[model samples]
Target: MKKSTLLIILLFITIYTYAQRDQTNQEPGSTAFWENLSKLCGKSFEGEMLNASEKDQFYGKKLVMHVRTCEDGKITIPFHVGDDHSRTWVLTMEEGGMIKLKHDHRHEDGSEDRITQYGGTSSNSGMSKIQFFPADQETTDLIPYAATNVWWITLDETSFTYNLRRINNDTAINVKFDLTKEVETPPTPWGWED
Candidate 1:
């Protein structure tokens, strides 16, 4: 009798779980739904100088990627060069949540530049590691598959800042992004994903 009762209880729980998931999928118009679709937003951080010693003599230029967005195991970074407008960076999550920043760039001439590798970092420990890939040869739906390079990102609520470096790229060396601003985190599409 005890075994039968336990089996019945388990069966009911399984049905309830499936019912909840189905409800979420077919729900009517909701801002929450749109928010859930957009996994990235509401992140802010301060940029700054980094220890040039990490790369040693091979250190690339200093740089910064501010207000980067990462959600659903992916991150799209938006950054501006010194007085040089801005460009979008796409990074994707890999095994262990390591970030491989897709190598891609747009020239002022509206042309695509070669994908070069620099270096990357993550704040939430090893949850994310910024590694370099060749170019957008392949990518997941989460990122630009054409990207020859990319990065992995782990989900975290706290804001993080990273110094940008261009290694083995045609750009100049010793460039760094100094964090000089702070902004409010806008509401997440998922509302409470934070």
Candidate 2:
């Protein structure tokens, strides 16, 4: 084979290899999961605490969640428990296809709370229906007792569940919402712009 032809073939092979690697690193599973969740934007659902205890603060409250905002690489969900609209769940797609979950908490005056923005990034490429976020360093720094916390979310055609578990402990919270039913969207969460 001619030297020029050989060089051309080598370059083509290198480009193809790099392209494949880049695509693979994009984490198709995570992307699919994001897309699936984004489809629920602007919808609202009523939720119930699955493992509620008498001492659980959220017990017997009217729990609602709104998939209020969906933007490129980001989704914002506001969780309302009775009259408390201080919590919003933000899912951001990070570089290399990871997803970061952050809880934005605010007071009635729309001011940031002291224990806010604590969550973690997905440790691996989770399935299209679920993803797990272990406590990130920032979370541990802000809330030392939550260092062992792991939060996972699952979404399907009929339901969506948000769960938290503390490794090596019995502390857990599981809230499941019925996707089959659409509820009225709640008001803007605290600290969120209209």
Best by TM-score: 2
Where does candidate 2 stray beyond 4 Å?
A: 1-27
* lDDT measured at residue 31 in model 2 versus the true structure, 0 to 100: 84
- The window of 10 residues in a row where model 2 has the poorest summed lDDT is 23-32
Model 1 segments beyond 4 Å from truth?
Answer: 1-46, 51-64, 68-71, 95-97, 116-125, 128-181, 184-194
- Candidate 1 lDDT (Cα, whole model)? 0.41
| Residue-level lDDT tens digits of model 2 in 116-147 | 99999999878889999999999999999999
Lowest lDDT block of 10, candidate 1: 185-194
- For all candidates, the clash counts are 31, 0
Candidate 1 local lDDT, residue 188: 27
- What's the TM-score of every candidate structure? 0.36, 0.86
Instruction: Please provide, for model 1 over 64-149, each residue's C-alpha lDDT reduced to its tens digit, 9 standing for 90 to 100.
Output: 35445656655555554433323555555455433455434555554554533233422222312122233333333224432333
